[model samples]
Target: MERKQFLRTLGTGAAFALTFPCLQGCSKDSDNGDIEEIPSGVDFTIDLNSSEGAKLADNGSFILKNLIVVVKDLNGNFVAASQVCSHESYDQVRFTTNDGGIFYCDVHGSRFDLDGAPLNQVDSTPAKQLKIFNTELDGQILRVFE
Candidate 1:
């Protein structure tokens, strides 16, 4: 083939190669429906002396257990909420010191207050409230329950 014809064929083949994978990735059938659900019947405890419990010793610190995000608020209060984000049901929620200690999902910018209420609109719609579990501290053990 001539140089000009070879160059045209190579460019077209390269363009098709790059675009095909992206187009395939955009198909709805490729979605695995992997959205997570808020945990239920979640009764569990953490020992203050254990390594996992030590994470919550500091104010504004948090730990994830049983699909739950347990946090020590800035005021030193223990609170527990589901790690599942209300928007898109992704398990990416965590407590952050930002906005005075709120649960934030990095996946879609979904924010929830300590009370599990949505803080802002996500995806142009009001996101649902996160599941908030009750927390009780007795001696050196913290109990989290639905």
Candidate 2:
């Protein structure tokens, strides 16, 4: 190959290599049933009178728009939290069937309290607290917001 052509090809390859990683990191965070962006002061309500909404009870939880998980505390109060697992950003958190009032992440065995606080002995390192939202139950309607 000619010296000039080889130098040009090498320069192009180096440029591509340097640009690839930055492009990959620029993608937005994503997951199944996830909301792309949550605006400030978001407030929404779930109708318990509906068929699927009727399934929730005290000490249980329901996933909202697949983004937030709403937990009904043992005292019959409602609480909300981001369903995404902080350690690895998984969205499979659910209430354990026991009386522990905890949300269990199926991905890595992380436990979070109904109030979205990280529980002790989290299996993953650099454990992160779940993002909690304010919740209020008004008759058959449960409102959740950040």
Candidate 3:
């Protein structure tokens, strides 16, 4: 190949390698990485009977602490996970009971199990697991923490 042609090809390849990740919605330090993140060492409670907590009744998805996805399982159990999609950094994940309770990411169609394990990935890359938090129920309140 001619030197000029080779140089052009190399430049294009380098550009794509650097640009592909951002286009794929990957998180960056200045962008989506901290958009959903909350202050660390946080501990809070949600009243199950309150209007704000109504959306989390049963098998419901609730976004708390900006990045946390709090879901109520079929058995009325509370589970907390990062709302950020593993494939990308999309902060829109919903709980679905269609396949025995899974978190579905609208951006990349990625599915995560209740324990934050990846059930599926939208691309050839290895699936990313979600960050999970601990939750406890006390009468009509649910406490969430890291």
Candidate 4:
């Protein structure tokens, strides 16, 4: 085949190869309910003396355990929320220092306050609130519970 004809065929083939996979991925039946559910009945503890717990000593630092994001707020208070984003149910939520201290989902820019209240709208609708768990610090043990 001529060089121009070969190049034209290659471009069309490449476009077709890229298009079908995206079409299949975007189909309605593609989702098989595999998304993780927000953790419930979540009762766990972290020993502040342990290496993992030591991270909370720094304000604005956070740790992920049992699909939960535990954070020490800027005011030096322990707070916990689900790592699952309420917008898309993706496990990409974490504590951020932005706006003082808030839970942010890296998946779709969903933001929530320390109280788990939605701070922004997603897809033109208000995003759902996060599942905020309770935290109690007894000496060195921090208990996180739903």
Candidate 4 local Cα displacement, residue 7, angstroms: 29
User: Residues 71-111, candidate 3, lDDT per residue (tens digit)?
Assistant: 88777689887776767667766677778778887665888
TM-scores of all models?
Answer: 0.75, 0.63, 0.67, 0.75
Write model 1 residue lDDT over 1-146, tens digit each, in one string: 69999999999999999988888877744553346878999999999889989989999999999889999999999999998777888788999999999999877688889999998876877679888999999998999998
lDDT of 2 by residue, 1-146 (tens): 69989999999998898888767665432323332332236588888888756767645555554477776766666777776666567666666647567877766678887766777556637667877788777889888876
After superposing candidate 4 on the true structure, give the runs of residues whose Cα lies further than 4 Å from its correct spot: 1-34
- Candidate 4 per-residue lDDT over residues 102-121, each given as its tens digit: 99976667889999999888
| Native-to-model Cα distance after best TM-score fit, residue 18 in candidate 1, in Å | 21
- For each of the candidates, the C-alpha root-mean-square deviation to the true structure, in angstroms, is 6.7, 9.9, 11.4, 6.7
Worst 10 residues of 1 by lDDT: 26-35
What's the TM for model 3? 0.67
Off by over 4 Å in 3: 1-40, 59-65
* Colliding pairs, model 1: none
Residue 86's lDDT within candidate 3 is 65
